[model samples]
Every structure is written in structure tokens, then in C-alpha cells.
Target: MFPGPTIPNRQPHREPWSRERLMYERAIAMGNAIDSTSRYTYGSALNSYLTFVRIHNFPVDPTEETLSFFTVYTSNFIQPRSVASYLSGVCNQLEPWFPNVRAARRSMIVTRTLEGCLRLKSVPVSRKRPLSLDDLQIVLSHFHHNPSHDDLLFISMLLTGFFALMRLGELTFADNPRLRNWRKVSRRSTVTFNDIQYSFHLPSHKADRATSLAEHAVSPTLIQAMGRWSSEAFKIYVRKHPVLLHALLFGADH
Candidate 1:
């Protein structure tokens, strides 16, 4: 018999990634780094869904029926937005394992139920009252009379933050303080003179991530309060702990 025609060796074709694809991948990586809080929130929501399934003896596979029931059941205790957040959390957890399961969230029945719940359970929103100048005076007076180095620092932070529109996080460390490499106000950056103005740079803030070096002039009233606290008080406080000169405008004690 004649030998069959020799077949040519073949290799799998590999397509080069487009610029858009490369950029998309890089964007996802950066997004993952920044969404630590969202990850935690979604994880907590998934845990609640799992607990509900275990207790109710529902099927492991999420169906439209299951999601609809869950929305109604959860609505008794939580607002529609919260139930929606929980549903999103559950969907995120399940999508990897059951790629076709997203239909549960998109179901018309589930959507109608969520809308009905929102109408039934809605309440008027309450907002925080803004602080007035008089309110600020009372706070400053209390700290001024106390006259401890800590109290002086507190006064300085209050006055500067009020005028500058600074967030609490920028002015002070979180509850569990640790040194981070992010930009912060330093003593050398501060200019406390007859002018009574503060100048410091922030690498990032809640509103924006762009680097900002700003100087906010202190009001005459605030300047007098700062005098009572004494510039020497701040200098002495930083002297004992040199790190404060670099880490914060109002650094930690001890």
C-alpha cells in the first residue's frame, strides 16, 4: 500500500493582545488594589446569604425563585438598598463557580419585589446638623482651659481643620495608629508667625488623590486661640518625639 501523504506539524495560533486589552488588564489590577473595603463588604454579604441558605434548607444553586424569596424575607428587617447590596454580594461569590447563575439578579420577579419593598419601607432621610461658629468657640474654650500639651494639640487641629475643610483622617491617625508611608504635614512645612498661617502638602485625600500643597490663613479669632495654646507647647511636644515632625501636623502622643 502507498504511504499516506505526510501531514505538516502544526502549532496552535496565538493572537497578540490589542492595546485596549492590555490597558483593561492593567486597570483591573489597579482597581483590585484600591477596593479592599468593597471586598470586605461583599464577603460579609456573602456570609449572610450562606447562613440563610443553611438555615432555610434552600437549594445550593441560586434560582430566580430563591432570590425572589430572599429579597422579600430580607426586606422585613433591612431596607431595599441593603437587600440589593446583599444580592450583589451573593452574585459576586457565585459567579466564579456558576457562570450562568447571574439570571437570578436580573429576574423580573426579583426586581419587582425589590421595588415593592422600597415603597413599603421607605423613611425620611435624616442629616447631620452643621457646626456653627458659636459651637466651635465652646469646644476651643474647653481645650484652652485644660492647658495640657495634648489639649493644645487638639485646639490646633480643630482650628486648622475647620478653616481648611480637612477630614478627620487627614488630621489624625486611625483608632489603631501605625506609621504609613503616605504624605503628611511636617513641622518644617508649617509657618507659625504673626501671619498665623499653616502650609502642608497632602499626597492623597478622600475627595481626590492628586498631590496638594496648600496654605490656609487662620482667622484672627483662631489665631488668638493658638497663641493661648502657645507655639512653644507644640515645639516642646514635637521635640520629645522627633518622628512627629514628619508624620503629622497633630502627631500622636507617646
Candidate 2:
């Protein structure tokens, strides 16, 4: 057989990136992994860290001792819980620069210092009270007198949202057009109804209140799926109603 037509040697379409350039690109990719808001928060944390080091004449590197001290010092000004969040942000920002920053942050010294700060500087939690059926009834009474189209619409949304356990974001579009996401919205086309009841396709819903009602009624797996929880982190959101707790403790026979 005739020798295969000799192929001419061709140069690579692209040149291999230098090690330094590759490293820089990788760091950029790491930053892009988190949202812009999260990046801003992390950037603030890093700035705080840099300021701390500069003022104290400490090394820029994040060592266990430095991170621990930073945690304690920062906690004195902000809430200890906020300090913890700040540390998490710091770790995210610094991890690319100092590969072992996470390990340093997680070290026993840093963790214990953070824990001690929390105890030393304890603040009362100021959580907003969740809306109840009584609140719903009050709203209904307000609209009952002279319900305009807008008023009726408000009542309809209120009822549907309460039962569906929808978030405020799901119920309404953002005032800022830039923030409004059509993909997240539930349009009229998604709704269906019969004489008995009406239902709509919710693009997403992760109501903590749903856990209060369904805690005993459903399996943990089902609850997690409904809550769209990737981990057991949903436990933090769980606020067991006293009645539900009592029922769980006792039985249907009781």
C-alpha cells in the first residue's frame, strides 16, 4: 500500500499557560464560585484581617494564634455570632492566598476562642415573631368591610402564601427591576383550581414554619426533601410547636 500521505507538522492552536498565570486564573475561578454579595462580605472580612495585622505589627499570614486573637478582638466590638460569620468569610477569602487558612481557622485555639467570646459577650436574640392564624384572621377582617380588587388580591395572596408556606420573595416581585427574576416567579399560568381547592406550581419554597407543622407528620427524609435541605442544617430552623411536641411525646390514643 502507498505510504499514507505525509501529514505536515502543525503548531498547537494555543500555547501552554505559565504556572503563575494558571495560578492567577485558578484564584479568579475560586472567587467566582461564590455570589457577588458573598464576595463583598468576604472582602470586608479580609480587609478587617489586614487592618488587624497592620495595627498590631503582626505577620500578614493567618496562623492559628493570629486567627484566634482576631476572633476574640473582633467579638468585643461586634456580636460574637457576627464575629463567627466574619471568620467564616475570612477563611473563604484567604483560602486561595493561604491554602491552609481553613485548617488554621478550624484549629482548636481559634474555635475555643470564638466559643469563649460568645459566652463572654452574650446578647439577647431579637427574632421577629412569626405570623399566626390570629394575624391571618385580623387581615381577613380588615378586608371584609370593603374589599377592592387590590384588597381581594392581597387577601388571596395572604391565604395562598400562608397555606403554601411561601416566602415573601416568591409572593411578589422585587421593587428593583434588576433584582426581579422571572425564573423564580410563579405566574398565573402555573395556577390550577377546582370547586374544592386551588393549587399552583411553586418554583421553590423552603419555609421553616413548614417544619413546625410537618415535624411529626412526615419522615425526616421527606421533610428534608420538602425543605430542600442539602444537609441536617435544617435542624437550626426547626421550631417545634408545644402542641406538636406534646403530641409527639404522647400518642394519638392519649
Candidate 3:
């Protein structure tokens, strides 16, 4: 009458994950290693390599000679500096498939081909002139008399960008709504102003370059801190304007 040996209750058994599923997840994680723009650039470079191989009836496997030839071919149309970037893109994208792609890219033949392209096809770099205090004065004079709301806004942005060493994109929203990121946008509440001065919170910025009107007049350390520069790279952006140079030699009062 003891119930003929009681049975133990147990949960149902589950199957272990398949290798394919785990690999697929790992592949997705790997893909996310680079940002969207880099992904696009690397993907384009990979596609270009594939197309070259297909059209030339060459093996899909990358080699020193093939990459060198590719470099020379691309250099014919694009700048040699850009071709170097393309090679970097190719290395990043192809390393997963061809473990030795970087080795091939770094080969003497490939490197020399890129250098030859540079020597043959390089052009002088054209950079837009940096804004100066005189430019700010011009803007100020334009809005001196009875500024409208939009004009005031423009002036505010110009002044902030000039003094804070901020980019225009940091101060305003993109014209295309889709391109706007709320996280990066500064809200009105973040800005505070008084008769003497004004300040605002910057959510994010790509502080690659910066210059200050008070360059030589102030401590380099202070300028670096104000610009939130992480390195001395900011020195490269420090323009040697006549006014700043004069201030360096003479006192600020002079």
C-alpha cells in the first residue's frame, strides 16, 4: 500500500545550442566592432577588391602583387592619400577572411606603389581659411542695428563658436530632421546668460581642432582646459595670426 515506490518529479530536458547559432551570434557581434561610417567605408573597399578580382579573373585570395596592382589602379583615379585610407579599410574588412591581408598590404611592393602614386599624382591641399577676430567684428557690425530674432540667434552662435572653439554643427540642429540627434543637441534650458557673460552645456563634440583669440595672452594650459583638448594636438590648430603674434611679443595692453 506504500504506492509501489513514489516517482520523483523532474523538469523537461532542453537541447544544447547548435554551433551554427553560436557562430551567427558571434559574427553579428564582430560586425558591430566598427562605427557605421567605418563599416560603410570598409564594406565599399571590400566590394571594390572583389570586383577587381572578378573582372581580372584573379583568385579571390589577396596577395602582395594583387594588392600592389590594386593600389596602383585605384591611385590613377583617387588621391594617393585616399588610396592609403582605402588600403586601411581593406585591411580592417578583409582580416577576418584573409588572416594575412595586413601582411600583404604592408609588403614593400604595395607600399612603394602607394608612394609612387603619391609622387606622381599628389596635388596641393586646399584648406578653407580659418575664421579670425576680424570676421567676428564684421558679423557684429552687420547685426549692430536693431537685430531680429534670427539675426540675434546667428550672432549668438557665431560668438559662441568663435570664443568656445566650437563647430557650427555643435551649436545648431541639422536642416534635415532625420540627421538631428537629440542626445547631441543642446536644449534651451542648458544655456544661461547675463549682462557680463553666458554659458551652455555641450552634450558632445568632436574637438579635433580649436583656436582661441586669447591664444598667446593666456596660459596654454588654460586654453587646453577650456577647449577640453585631450592632447597637445591642439597646438597644430593654434593659428599664428599677426595680432596673436604681436600679443606674444608685447603685453596685452600694448
Candidate 4:
């Protein structure tokens, strides 16, 4: 024991961390993050955290400043929805480290991150867009003396669509309530477009992304041929026919 006071045998007081030890210890600790193949994904998140720490000597606490730093750092690059994949690793490890997050409101950023991207699209309304009698006439005119496939489809749509104002999905999809009944009825006689919606309990269709039908409505004869519709069932029918789309589009309601 040295003089001053007989110093009893004592364990050395541990020294505070040095920058060098921090770097070396960080590397050693990173070994834990590495996968069996020595790769880091979940481990890479650990790597990111360590790298962030080494770069900034950040504290071991989740603060608003920490959250801001993370949001800003990620904002450095534009990324796709695959962000979830990259972040799966970060989220797993940081979940315990990060504070609890409350339910967030719906916004463009959340929608974009989840849905990937936005697309400009047009879709038909399911609301009944009843056609005027004159517009019905324009649709009828397309029939001519003889009708082609397009003409027949066009005529069938118009004849049925006028009073019905149906969604394109129900029109195109044969499973429609009216279509199912029409299929059965059409077999009995030459079905008219007017009969499909007016007499039959045809439910209107709705629209959504990856769902619904296009906006364009078809012609009268098309309704009859396609749905085996009966025009006489309608309260009003196109009494005459016109020549072209413009005529129907800009027709004077009779």
C-alpha cells in the first residue's frame, strides 16, 4: 500500500468512452446485427442506426428532434411503396426504441406511400343519366337498314340505357340482374331494349379503382341484342332514329 492513506487493493475506476473505442466497439457490436451469412437487412437497420449515431453522436433517446431527423433524412430521396420493405428492418429494431405512434389521419403522403402512386382516370357515374327521347332517336338511327356487330352493340346499349341509366359494368357484365332475367326472357321472343330496366328489377352499378365501367353509353339496338332488353317496357322510347354520335350528343329532346 502506498503512503498517504494505506489504499486498500481497489478495482480501477472505469474511464469514460474514447472516440476510438466507440468506433471499434461499434464495429464489434455490428457483428450482432450481421446475419448468419454476415449480411444485414434487419441487421442493416442496426447498421443504419449505428452509422447515424457515429455520424452524429446522437443520444439513446427518441425525441421529436430524432423523429424530425429521420423524416428529413428519408426525404433525401424519392422512393416507391417498397419503402415498407426497406423500413421493415428499421421498424422491427427501432420499434422498441421509438415512442408509440398514434393512429394517423388519411393524407396524400400516406396514400402515396401505401398505394405507390396516383393515376388520373375517368369513370362512368352509376347515377341514372336518363337520356332524352331525341337522344334515343339518335342512337336508333345508327341501326340503318342492316346493323354490324358494333352497330348492334351500340343499338342495344342505347335502347336499354336511355331510361335505365345503368352502370357500364352491369351493361358489359352479363351477370347483371336484368341481364340474367333478360337472358331468360330474350329466349322467349325478340326482346326490346325498353323492357330491360323498366320492367325488370335491374340494380344500378357503382365505380371504383380496379372496378366499374368506362363512361361511354351505348345505343338502343345494342341493349336489345346484348341484354335481350325490351324497349316497350320503358315509360318513353325513342320513336325515331338519327345518323351519328354528334346527333345523339347534341340532340333536341322531343
Model 3 scores a TM of 0.70
Predictions ranked by TM-score, top down? 2, 3, 1, 4
How high is the CA lDDT of each candidate model? Answer: 0.63, 0.77, 0.75, 0.44
lDDT by residue for model 4 (1-254), tens: 66664667586788889999998898778545533322345665556645665678787443445433543454344343333343455554555446342111123344343343212221232443335566667767757778889888877766655445454544664453422333322232333347433344444322111001111344444534443435663213233222233344443332
TM-score of 4: 0.26
True-structure Cα RMSD, model 4: 23.7
Per-residue lDDT over 163-231 for candidate 1, one digit per residue giving the tens place of the 0 to 100 score: 554566667753423333234533444444456555655544332110111112223234334334355
Task: State TM-scores per candidate.
Answer: 0.54, 0.70, 0.70, 0.26
Of candidates 3 and 2, the better by TM-score: 2
Q: Output the lDDT of residue 186, model 4.
A: 22
Candidate 4's error at 171, in angstroms? 0.5
Where does candidate 3 stray beyond 4 Å? 1-21, 144-153, 168-189, 192-197, 205-209, 219-254
- Please give the range of 10 consecutive residues that has the lowest summed lDDT in model 1: 207-216
How do these models rank on lDDT, best leading? 2, 3, 1, 4
**Runs of candidate 4 exceeding 4 Å displacement:** 1-102, 105-133, 174-198, 203-254
